[model samples]
Target: MVLIFLFSGIQAYAVDPEVPDSEEAISAGQSIFNANCKTCHRLDQKLIGPALRGVTDRRELAWIKQFITNSQVLVQGGDADAVALFKEFNNTVMPAHDFLSDGDLTNLLSYIEFGDKVDPAAAAAAAGAEGGEAASSGGGIPNEYLTIILVVLVIVLVLVLVVLGLIVSVLTKYMNKNDDLDEDDKAFINQKTDYKGIFKSDGMIIIVTAIVLAFVVKTAINGLYTVGVQQGYAPSQPIAYSHELHAGQYEIPCQYCHTGVEIGKSANIPSANICMNCHMHIQNVEGKDGISPEIAKIYDAVDNNKPIEWVRVHNLPDLAYFNHSQHVVVGGVECQTCHGPVEEMEVVSQYSALTMGWCIDCHRNTEIDTQGNEYYDKLVQLHSESSNDALKVKDIGGLECAKCHY
Candidate 1:
């Protein structure tokens, strides 16, 4: 009993007499504290102000609310209790927040009462919104998947057609002899069996002629479609060059080897001097038992031991006038964009068809990075007014025949 009394005495001394015990009062205090008090005071740590971790344990909620509402007022009233606290906190005066509404104050207090607990409902709602956005942002379906589905559909259709054909053949063979058949039935029978030299018969001949005509028309259409097409053209080069090597392992910059990219029309093949730049140091290489065959070719080309013959890899037709700098430097296209991931290639072959259609398709999709270039300011303004964010090469006169031909 004596120890209990001692403990109670200490607790009584800690709490202010003015404070009240009420949930509403504590809630009201909390809202105001979060909005204003949170800027300086944390529940446990001394940020700019003293920690309020166990303030409720130390003082009555009512007293705390009174101090919160107006600490200066309590001090002015000669409240030794308030004065002592102000002195204890190094006379650091807590500011009054007159702007906070009663409801706002209540919410702030509720947060303090609950402390830190994850709200599952809020988390779930956020996750749902994120998932919905991700679903919306994705393209409808990948082409490969769509193609696979289409192929399966086609295969199913073909199987159905073949089965139907077989069924018709069997039915015709069985029913033709069994019928005192009608004219159409007899004709179908004749078509099916071709018995008694049906190929010599007029109707059968007409049907065959019609089929031959239809085949001819389809073939003509297909031939027209392929007039200027070169789908699988693999041209021979003078050099046994492997786009795979220089582009693949070494990651030699395309422009470094193709030095004429920025300054002139072609991404010209490196001269013997450029080859010597690296080859001089790399001669008698380590990889394949020294004396690298490829590097040796460069040495021979320089005529240190007679001029080496280098076959040309890419040769634009004389009729077409193309400028590498216009596309590479001005347009800002990487070599690999056209050449296709050459760094991974051992022997570089033309990845793109490089046809007019291919070029136009690329032009249609590519966007220009015109954010800060003063040269594009006028063009950008025009585009902004036109409501087109994408700037294709064609929009910048890239597709004009004169641009390529002249």
Candidate 2:
């Protein structure tokens, strides 16, 4: 019955010519949009780039495809519309998505044109539902609003201080006019605080000295703890290879390049031959004539039989042992779970802290996938008997020192 409904729905679906109307295509396009375009462009709203909802009406389908694939190509070739857009956006280089195929682009356009559509009434309802939280969370208050709020707060605080001063002055005058007051009462009321002298006293000096010393100690300890943690480390490679184009925009399977990830302890660096498999043919891009400088480096390395001296980014300590196969294959963890979005990064950086605490936290939280594993059958049964909760990695020997240690 479900299959019949799905088939009927698909059959009933119809979109514009060349653009897909199917649920699958639209869903795929949404994923693609999230991965690449969401950073700069929005479908219905203007972001860093223009709103892209009605781009089809503005430009031909072929022109849209060309511009998306490589906008600079069109701009340099004196395409009037492309040049205007480039100038309008202050010549912000929209990263080349030549990695995207024809089908991918068509699906993307389909989503831009047809997906996430809501009528005026529905939009109003959604706006009402979102009210306060949306207003607060939309990148905090605007800078101008924040500045105004701060100024108002300062003014109010100053006004309060002034009123307090006036009240104190009036009370002091009233107290002085009282002839019934004793000598001790008048002396107490007239007493002046020596703030400067108090600060210069031994106790105040000791407190300030201790606070400064404590702060220095804390900063030193923090620096020591961060010695091995290279969280955002990004080193330049010998050859400027872009993971954004390959891993992200192109949707290349990570396992295709990093072959040993599922099979071995180390996800070994891909050889030049693996690069040449594609680059041997794809020497130029963006309708260019000569070989690209970056691609030339690859060709040179291949011809000379010398390995490219790629700089290592994520380096685990010698004491710590990490196995890619254990986490990726056995545990079914996504690469993005640890490595972050390598597809979006032009130069890949170390996304995770890769610290002991981080690993332990992940193990404690991540559920163990025991399905189809004969070894886990007894363990799962035992775990089920002990606790109603799903079996986690830490519940097994995941937290055990020997599990990760040599």
Best by lDDT: 2
TM-score for every candidate vs. truth? Answer: 0.40, 0.46
Q: Which candidate is the best by TM-score?
A: 2
lDDT of 2 by residue, 1-406 (tens): 9578555644444435788667888888999987878756678776557889878778889999999999999999999999999997768677889999999999898888767654557788666554433333224444456667789999999999999988988999999999999999999988877889998999999999998999899889867755644788776667778889988888888888999999988898899999989986886676965456678677656655789878788888888899999989899999899999888999989999888999999989998989899989999999999899899999998899987788
**What's model 2's TM-score?**
0.46
- Model 2, position 239, has a per-residue lDDT of 76
Q: Model 1: runs farther than 4 Å from truth?
A: 1-241, 285-290, 304-308
Q: Supply the TM-score for candidate 1.
A: 0.40
Task: Give lDDT: candidate 1, residue 280.
Answer: 63
Give candidates' CA RMSD values in order.
27.8, 20.5
* Residue pairs clashing, model 2: none
Residue 186 CA displacement from its true place in model 1, Å: 62
